[model samples]
Target: MAEENGAAQPQVKMQVLAQFIRDLSFENNVALKGLTGTEMQPEVQVGVNLDAKARSQPNTFEVNAKFKVTSVNKVNGDTLFLCELDYGGIFLIEGVPQEQLHPFLLIECPRLMFPYIRRIISDVTHDGGFPPLNIDNVDFLALYRQEIARRQAAAQAVAN
Candidate 1:
């Protein structure tokens, strides 16, 4: 709560206006290469990137979460599959202070969109001739802090 002239100010408001996939691609290397193995130990790695921009409408913004998943056979180190997804959401946000808006958009908006993104990846992997891949929950706050630290380090290096 924020105090304004001795009274508490209104709480922040946020709403999801819409969600959609901007781009998606899946490649099944096992099928492509016809790799046959009795023991298939798969190792998967996931990468996430986020972007946000204000919309023309007031108090509205678009946030995009880009996910890339790659699976390789642990035993032979051969590529198994690859999936790339760009998911986005349109949000209606209000009452948030300007200084805090960037973090809110990058952290909160992506957190809200993660579950759907996870499901899509799982389904894509399953349908692509592999076991379902359930991704671990992301800690957006930690990611944001790490990015801030990296930026500071880069700036310091440039200054030096």
Candidate 2:
């Protein structure tokens, strides 16, 4: 519970109104080109980006998580596959202080949507003719901190 003007604040409430895939693309390079090696060893890399914006409806916001996944053959450095996904969720949030809203949208919202994002990635990779790739869970808190630090650095550079 939070205190406002010496009065206890109401409990925060958040609801995911909806979730959808804004965009998705998957390319299997191995299928395009014949496999050169007898054994396939893939090195996968995933990148994540987040964005949030307020909607016209009061207390409603949209949060988007963008993921870019690339896999390459560890031995030959040949590209195996690439997947890019943009997933968005609409949320109705209330009772949270205005000062905490930004972080709530960027961090908590994406954390909630991560499992679905992971599932989509796995399904796409499996259906694309390769083994299912289950990616590791993301650290949204660390990612948020890094982005904040990056913005601060950019601002400092511009000021200098």
Candidate models: Cα lDDT each: 0.92, 0.94
Best by lDDT: 2
Instruction: List the lowest-lDDT window of 10 residues for candidate 2.
Output: 1-10
* Candidate 1 lDDT tens digits, 58-87: 999999999999988898898899999999
lDDT of model 2 at residue 70?
Answer: 98
lDDT value for model 2: 0.94
Candidate 1: the clashing residue pairs are none
| Model 1 segments more than 4 A misplaced | 1-5
RMSD of each: 1.6, 1.7
